[model samples]
Target: MFPYFCLLIVTSFCAITEPFYKKQKSIKCILLSCFIVLVLFSGLRYDVGMDYLSYKTWFLSGRGFSEQGFILLTRIFRSLGPTIGFNFFVFIIAAVTLYGAYRFIYKYSSAPLLSLFIFFCFGQYFISTLNLIRQELVIYVFLGCLLPLIIERHFIKYTLCIATCSYFFHYTALILIGIYFLDRHFSAIIKLSGIALITISSPIIIYLIENSDYAVYLKLDIFVAKVTVLQYYLLALSVIIALLYFKCFQGKPMTKKDILFENINYINILFGIMIIMFSNTPIIQVISRLSYYTMPIYIILIPNFISRLSLRSNRLIFRYAFILLYTLIFLVAITTNGKLQHYVPYHSIIF
Candidate 1:
C-alpha cells in the first residue's frame, strides 16, 4: 500500500505539472524517467501479482501454456540458462507492455503525463500488466497499432495486424477488427445500427454458447462474474461525460485531429451502452471483455475532450473533476479489490 501510494502521488504530480513544461525535450525526459520507473516496478516484482507464482511455476516446469506466444517466449527464455530465464522473461514482457503503452500515449494523448497517470491508477491497468501479461500485451498493441489503423481507415492493414497479434497473443484480440467499422467515416446510421445489432444478438449468442459443446470449455459462471462495481461506475461515467460533451460542444468546429478523439469517445459511449445493457445478464463477462477493447481509450478521450472546451473555467472544472473521480476509483481499487491486494507490500527481486 505504501509503495503503491507513493507511485500514485509521484505520477500524479508529474501529470499535473507536465503542462508547465513548454519544451518537448523536457516532456520527453519526464516521460522517459517515469516510464523507466514503471517498467522496473512492474518487471522486478517478486511473489506479487495474482499470476506471479503460476507464471513462474509454468516457466520452470516447461509446461505448455494456452497462448502459443507465451509458450515460445518461455522456451526462448529457458534456453538462456535456468538462473535468469524466468525472471528475465517477466522483465521483457513488462518492457514490451510499457513500451506499447508509452508509444500509445506519445502518439495520441493530449496530456501524456495525465495519460500515464491513468495507465497507472485507472482501474489498476498498471498492476494488471503483472497479472494479465499476454492480454495486456495484446491490449496495448491494439492501442498503439490497431487503433491508429482504425482511425486511418486502413481496413486491410488493421485486419492483418489484428490477425497477427491474435495468433501470437490473446485470441480475444481478434474481436478488435470490428472496431474499424465504427470509425467516423461511416454514417451515423451504420455505426448505431452495427452496435444495435451486436446488442440485440448477445442473448442469442449466449444461449447458443450455453447450449453448445463449447459451454464446458468456456466455464461460464454467473455466480463467479468478475465485473466490478468500479467498472460499472467508470463505464456509466464515460457515457454521461460523452453525452454531456456532445450536448455542450455540439457544432463546434472540430479539427481533423479532434476527429480521432471524437471517434474514440463515440465508440466508448457505444460500448458503455452495450455493457450497461448487459449489466444484469449472465453474459456480462462476455460483454465486459468486449467493451474493454475500447475502454482504455477513456484515458485519451477525457483529456482531449477537455481540451476541446471553449471556456477555460469549464476546462479547469472538468479536469479537476475527472482527476478527483479517477483518484477515488484508484483508492477504491487498491483498498477493496481482492485481486488487487496481491499487488501490495510491493516486492521486488532486487530488494
Candidate 2:
C-alpha cells in the first residue's frame, strides 16, 4: 500500500510538473505507461477475489453460460495453470480498462493533468484491490469507451449498443442505461428530492423486503444478505458529498460534457445509497453494482475541479480537502475488508 501511495505521489507530481517541461509528451508517455504496467502487475499475482469463485464454478458446471462467459475464458486459461490463466485475464482486462480511462479523460477534459490526478485520486489506483473479475472490469472498459461516444451525440442507439455490450459481462450494466437518461434529464433538485424520499422510505422498504411477497421474486435465498449500519452510513455520506458537489459546481462555467461527468458521479452516489438502503434485496444488490460503471467519472471530474484552483492558497486548501475526503473513504473501504496489497509494487512491465 505504501508503494502504491508512492507511485500515486510520483504520478501526481509528474502530472503537475510535466506540463511545464519541454519534453512534455515523452514524460506523459512514460508516466502513463508506468501507470498501466503497475495496474497489470498488481492484478497478476493477486488472488482473484473470492467473488469470482462462484463464476468459476458456474463456468465449470456449464451453468449460467451467458453470465459466465468471461469466467469460461479464464477457466480455459486455468487449464493451462490457475495462476497463469488468472494473471493473464487480469493483465488483459486491466490494460483495457487503463486505456479506456485514458481515452475517456482525454476526450472529456482539456486538462490532462487534471484527468490523471482524478484517475489516481478516485478508485483508479485501487483497481487491483478487488479480486480480478473479468466481467466487472470489462464492463468498465467498455463503458469508458462508450461514454465518449455517448457524450458526443447523446444518441439512444449508441447508448443501447454500449449498454448491451456491457450487459454481456454483467446484467447490472443495464442500469447504466437508466443513468444515462437521468444524467440528461434530471435536475439537481429532483435528484435531492428523490434521495430524500428514498431515505425516508428506507425503513418501509427494508420491512417489505424482510416480510413480503416481493422477497420471493427478489430471490432472497441464501445468496442475499443484509449490509451493516456502517456501510449504510458511509453510503449516505457519499450521497451527501455528491449533492454538495453538484450544488458547488452548478451554474459554473462547466461545459455540458463536464456537467454530464459530474452527473454520473452523482448517479453513483445515489446508486450506492440505494444499494445500502436495500442491501437485503438481491435484485437491488445486483443492480447497485452498476455504480461501478461510473467510477471513472469521479477520477475525471474531481481532479479537473482541483486543477482549476489558481492561487497557491486556494490550491493548498483544495488539496488538503481532497486528501481528507479520499483518506476518509479509503479508511472506510479498508475497514470493510478492502485490502490494497494487490495494487502495491505493481510488477507487470511491458518494457
Candidate 3:
C-alpha cells in the first residue's frame, strides 16, 4: 500500500505541476517515469488478482475460437508457459492503457492530469486492470484508436484497428463498431424513450428470471442476479455531471469538436444506462463487455466538465463532489463486494 501510494503521489504531483503545451520533453519524461512504475507494478505481480490462476490456465491452454486475438497471445505464450505469458500480457496491457489514456487526455481534455486522477479514482487505471485483464486491453486498444477513427477521420486505419480488435473481443468490437458508425446526436424524445424502456423493462426481466420454467434452457439461470445498485448510482452521477456541463453551455458558443464530443458522450451514457437496466438479463456478459467500452467517455467527460467550465462555482462544486463520490465508491467496494476480497492485503510477485 505504501509503495503503491508513492507511485500515485508522484503521479499526482507530476499531473498537478505539468505546464501547458510547451515542453514536450518534460511531459514525456514524467509520463515515461509513471509508465515504468505502472508496468513494473502490474507486470511483475504473481497471483495478485482474483482471476490470476484462471488467466494462467487460459494462457496455457490457449483454446478458443472466439477472441482469436487473446487466443493468439496464449498460443505465443504456450511455448514459454503460463507464468511468462501472463507477465508479458500484463506488461503489454499496462503499457498500452497508460499510453492510450495519456494520449487521450492530452488531445481532448481541458485538464489532463485531473483526467488521469479521475481515471485512477474511477477504477479504470488500477483496480479494473488488475481483474478484468482481457477487457482492459481491448478497451484501451480501442481508445488508442479512437482519435484516428473519429476525431481525425482516418477511416481506413480506424476500420483496420476495429477489425483487429473485433478479432480479439467480438462483443466489444461489435459494440464499438456500432458506436463508431452511429456517433450522432439523438433527439431528446429518443433519449428519454430509451431511459423509459430501461425503467419499464426491469420488472419484466426480473419476472422472466424468476418464473420461466425454461430459464436454464434460455441461460436466464446464469443471469438470475439483480441489477447492481452501485452501477445505477454511477449512471445517475454521470448523468448529473453531463447535465451540469450541458446546462453551463446553454446559449454559449460551442466548437464543432465540442458538439461532436457532447453528442458521442450522450450516446455512451445511454449505452451504459441501457446495460445497467438489462444487468440481470441472459446477455449479462455481453452487457458487461459493452460497459467497459463506454469508459473513454467517462474519462474525457468528467474532467472536461469540471476543468473546462468558465464558471468557477461549477468547477468547485463538480470537483469536490467528484472527490466525495470517489470516496463513497471506495467504501462501497470494500464493504459490498466479496470478489474484491482478493484485492485486500495487496501483494505482488516482486516487492
Per-model CA lDDT versus the true structure: 0.74, 0.57, 0.64
Q: Whole-model lDDT, candidate 2?
A: 0.57
Tens digits of lDDT, candidate 2, 247-274: 6777666555655665766666666667
On TM-score, the stronger of 1 and 3 is 1
Q: Model 3: clashing residue pairs?
A: none
Q: In model 2, which range of ten residues has the least summed lDDT?
A: 340-349
How far off is residue 215 in model 1, in Å?
Answer: 9.4
Stretches off by above 4 angstroms in model 3 are 7-32, 80-82, 169-171, 197-213, 216-222, 251-256, 275-286, 311-321, 331-341
- Model 1, span 1-351: residue lDDT tens: 787888889888887776577897887788889989989988888888788888888888767476676678788899997659988988988998888888888888777877888888876477778787888888888887667677667889989988878877778888887767654444468667877887787677767876987667446454335546766677676667657656765776555445555566677666665666555455666666666666787777667767768897887677777777777878888888734558776788898
Backbone clashes in candidate 1 total 0
Task: State the lDDT of candidate 3 residue by residue for 1-351, as single tens digits.
Answer: 555456556655655564354676666666656666776777777676787777777777776346867688667766675666677776776677666666766677665655665666555445677777766766766665465566556667777777777776454565666555544455568867877877788668757766777566345465544556656665675687668656876777766556556665666566566666656566555565566766556666777766766787787677666656655665466445524546555567665
Q: Estimate each model's TM-score.
A: 0.85, 0.70, 0.80
Q: Which candidate is the best by TM-score?
A: 1
Global CA lDDT computed for model 3: 0.64
Candidate 1 clashing pairs, residues 3+ apart or interchain: none
